[model samples]
Target: MNFASAWNAQGPLARQRREAMLARVGQLRALEQRAAERSAEARAVFEKRGQLLPRERVGLLLDPGTPYLPLCTLAGYLQDAREPDASVPGGGVVAGIGFVRGVRCMVVASDSGIDAGAIQPMGLEKILRVQEIALQNRLPFLHLVESAGANLMRYRVEGFVQGGALFRNLARLSAAGIPVITVQHGSGTAGGAYMPGLSDVVIMVRGRSRAFLAGPPLLKAATGEVATEEELGGAEMHTAMSGLGEYLAEDDRHALGIAREVVGRLGRAPTPALPQGGRVTASLPPPPGEGWGGGAPQREDLLTLMPANLREPVDMREVMVRLVDDGILEFKPLYGAATLCAQGRIGGHAVGFVSNNGPIDVPGANKATHFIQWMCQLGHPIVYLQNTTGYMVGRESEQGGMIKHGSKMIQAVTNATVPQLTIQCGASFGAGNYGMCGRGYAPRFLFSWPSARTAVMGGEQAARTMQIVTEAAHGRKGQRPDPVQAKAQFDKIVQVFESQADAFYTSGLLLDDGVIDPRDTRAVLAFCLDTIAEGEAAQPRPMQFGVARM
Candidate 1:
């Protein structure tokens, strides 16, 4: 029982065991020192690039003085590596649980200094494990991605494959209902693009970050098209064309700042009861045409303000600003010119806006889909501005799968639970009308300007209908009717549609709620907002679905 008596009884075996334990402790201390050195190296690389390392990013994302529970602490083995102690979890990616603005969040960030942040099969497994943690904990996920692509060199290793597991993890993350915010601080190419695409929000820095499914070299070799890195997948491409990025920052710091702000907005606890002494509808403006100094401006005057041709252009921003609050925060303004969206205070209450472009055939129908889905999740009212001639057509539209995309928009709007209010400015025709949350879509209130044109098709399509009718009227056996008289009859038929006015009298039946002046849009939206806010009781959080593209 005594220490010396026990040691003497054990003899040589006890001495050997004691020495082995000491040796193992020394080995652990050495490993710890190496890990520290590697972390410092990683931090130095980021500092040289004027950026924060993965650890620093995590710290910034989490609340001050919070501890991070790391998921893994070891990296995989690699053949022919010179340094014996080169591998560790910090070498691949740093992932853990932390608090962000007091809300628990799962944080995962790539170690850009090691292997250029290339994701090996092991690293993919680690990321998936972290995603699982987020799901289990019901914590919002944040991915600070700065990677090149899959680790091609690791393919030869046992249990290694070419396709990484990040894609599958992304699918699971989407289904878990944990909101993922992905930030691209540097190059994000090939497989790296999927992480950001799978998240609810993607933030990218202008000059420091880029994301692409294919890089320039591969593109040039495969298609004989040459492009620079920036041209291939720069901030402009994703933000303006691909619609993959939610917000564009001036630099890396700005991007991180934006990510923090977005997470705060999304993670705030729902208010169960109205604040004490708070007015129920203090911010709401009165109903349309009530307590007003002057009636809304005439629809004919608004028509003159808009562009003439569908192919031509006008700044829909001007129209939105005039209709909504003074400071409208338009989201994805540079992407999809035909679709417009924004989140802003409508009569001092947050609301979502989805609108159609009158000048282009871009079926912003998909934007409407995203808008409706967003509203359902946020539990906010939606305002739609309708001015579309119809969904885009022709070969280009077909190539983009306009029909499929347009259908999704229609389905989202019709199925949405949130209060939707639509205003028809001029033209609302074809499927575009329904996608814009039209009357048939069951908006709480559907109003149109006096000059609004509501129909199954546009005037040009109506002209064709008249032409076909006139041609059919003249049979082969009988002499053709007088050409001038036939033309006059066609004109008369078209005039009936023109004089129909607003959404009513469509198909020779009353369909619309009624027409309101253009200037009354704000008042209408304000009243709708108040009604929606007052009606709904507190509801449970939304169920997660497959990842949204943008």
Candidate 2:
């Protein structure tokens, strides 16, 4: 590995900019905190019902001192432009990967305290992403479910149509030999009933859970019959009569105890072997920590390294030195100057890092395509640090076959079997986003720095394009464009475009898994990569189909 000596760790200008960027990272963290705390707003109601808040359930379910990676923390910010500040906390769910009884599992709980855990459009998308992660990683799926079903008043047909995939995924997980465990806390009526019905193991809170296909009002409307929630599908009835529930618990705390017991006994795949070296999950037996012992760049330096201003250019090598272990081993550097592909270690996991120095030209994209293929052959994970304006444009580039080369990069990213993680450190615009595994392509885990901006193109570029078209259209109509009016129009368009590109805006819509502090990048990537590695190493026993209810 070549030692990196270009960065002056104590440069005065770097310190000044680092401090400012640190404040922005802090601001985004505060917003996430506020959103997470929204569940506390329903504390009184939860207490009245003698229940714990959704997050509280999650806390008790997870083993103490173990790590948990929260996903989609802010799932609906500014989505309803009518009321931008309205809190849409956590997509009506509090979910992440956590450990239970020495077993690593995907833990998800309904955030019923807020809006009765009703899923909106983005909320539905959040669960779908969670399910996909659970399936891909071969993690056992565990959930504490008590939802009021979808919010019909704010419904979109697309969300409803896509929501069915959640149930389908549950079945797929079970069929794939991945356990689907669920706890019903309360009100699993109507469509919500399917959650418990499809689980491999269902734990029900005795008097609290109400998982009937129809409640009394609906029953009377449909069949002119009277039925209480218990008679239809209460915990006791389900356990003794319906055979839907596997275990009955006295209360919330007791239910979690049983759920932990379930994970401990569900038949583990194998004690998955670790690779050469990498950071190990605390839940797993510890491996040697990935570090050089000393002189590593300060994690906070990342804030200064990646300027918040998208237009500013910084050598990605400088950023790479601060992220990888003892700097990276360069590969084909002179062949493609704009794309920096190198071999490195993060948390001890051997990985290939592809970072953008600028817009990807034909050579850069081709280099990336070749590197991605080689990494897949080695079975190593690839980390894409997105900082590009996207593929180069213009007649010269087109004649040079920019599209053909760019498509190769996209194809490699899409089909590579190795786990891919995307971190949007700066500008992720145009084809750059797709080539870098934007949310649409679904990186195994995707996150953005508070400084990141994502869109089809930069705000200024989009505005200028619109401005030129407006002037041309007015001239064709034989009316000259008004100068002052045209300037105002350009400014308005930029504001709209930039707002949509902001990390907070995109993260809220569940565009990325969540925004992170610049310092947490290395550790977060290491943990996820380790999980994927572990999953890949395990030997799961797959049946022909999902276990069916007797």
Candidate 3:
């Protein structure tokens, strides 16, 4: 049945919720702008050196008019700095998926504007995550390299140890038949020298590029030898003698142009081609928004579908209508009302949709397990809209084998062959996160809404549970709990849990790919689906080892 008749987009509650959500969206945009502005502050410095900013370099490399979905822009927010107001997000990197020529590539640029593009701990993690994506999708890895390398003063042994993976991934990308391209715009000293050394193609700017294992001072100190940067690892030296760079240019703009030319000439094949001479006709599904109904459900209603209070129940089908192309064909709707299992179209792509109306009961877990397997059989990707407190707990649920059934659901999520995507729509607490394919379960991509909160359990629930345990201990010792002291402790625990559970806080640690606005949910899903579709149809040649520099 169509959802048009059931939805009330103009309702008073809907209007109020939409306003609240709009305010959250504005705040998200402002944070992203803050990072951009931080980088823009270095424009004068860059211009004086006849160079372009990191973002300007990225824009020049990408194909004009194509969509660019930036990822993890708020990572390190309130994490690297002491105060929230002083925190600069993005982990000193600018990364996303965008087009180069006609080919979609994973583009990563070092935000040298901030701290000279020093590798922040979270920045290293961000690069690793995106590199994993490139490998999984078989997309080309394009890097705009210009780093002061790891900040020596702030170095951690763990960061230095993990930094090796950056070079390793570059090699792996080449071995997987995914081209690793680099444009060296500035400093690439010490460990950073390996960035371009591992790439399949390296484009360097003549006067600006430097890729030395050690600068002048270090050289003299180590071996009593004196050598200038130009003599050691300048672009001209590397291109002419060291064989580290494949192409050299006179300026930053020229280097980026050479990068574009190199990509254009890679001779990569398009998506899987049809059989040459067979009389085979493939039947494709109707375009989005054409089959079940004419238009999409009002996205404005999405805000209202989720109440301000996480404990309040919501009809997730209201959310489904706004995201799906037309209407949902629900499965086992009567069998497990708390868990929604349905088939829907997202941008003409058939995806099995799972959402939670409340805690997953025995039947709800069973229903999800079966739906997941069925979707895998049909080769359809699964989308999880998580808003769960966890599986049902208490006497009846335990007797009904909740644990075993929940295990089945988690197992299904873990081993599913098709790609899975998750949106943290509301409360994702306890084992429910595992069952819903949360970050730990490794969904292909996971994003959260501004209102989403993730924790082992709710703050109040956790505090109350601890309080009960404390009272029991005191009773065992023949000493009653001091009510004032107990309440103080309870409040402290709640505050800590609640603060850490916020979406922005979790995102700062790269817990999710990024936090997205609820209104953009459908568009994000469509873009991601398109990306997965392209990768699935691509055929890349794999080698035993990555291409190595001679």
TM-score, per-candidate, Cα-based: 0.45, 0.92, 0.94
lDDT of 2: 0.81
Clashes of 2: 3
Model 2: residues with Cα > 4 Å off, grouped in runs: 1-3, 269-297
- Location of the lowest summed lDDT over 10 successive residues in candidate 3: 277-286
Model number with the top lDDT: 3
Cα lDDT of model 3 by residue, 1-550, tens digit: 3344375778887777777766766777777777878988998999999998888888888765555667887888888756877788899999887777777789999999888899999999999999998888888899999999989899799999989999899889999988999999999999999999899899999899999999998899999999999999999999999999999899988998898888888877532321121110111111111122222346556766676668867778788878988788889989888999989999889999999999999999999999999999999999999999999999999999999999999999999999999999999999999999999999888999888989999999999999999999999999999999999999999999999998888999999988876766877787788788888877788899988886
lDDT of each: 0.61, 0.81, 0.85
User: RMSD, each candidate, Å?
Assistant: 29.0, 4.2, 6.2
- Candidates 1 and 3 compared: the better one by lDDT is 3
Q: Please tell me which predicted candidate would have the highest TM-score against the true structure.
A: 3
Q: What would the per-residue lDDT of candidate 2 be over residues 308-366, giving only the tens digit for each residue?
A: 57667778777777777766887788877888899889878889989898999999999
Q: Of the candidates numbered 1 and 2, which has the greater lDDT value?
A: 2
Query: Ranking by TM-score, best first?
Result: 3, 2, 1
Off by over 4 Å in 3: 1-5, 269-297
Q: Model 1 off-target regions past 4 Å? A: 1-33, 42-45, 77-91, 156-164, 268-544
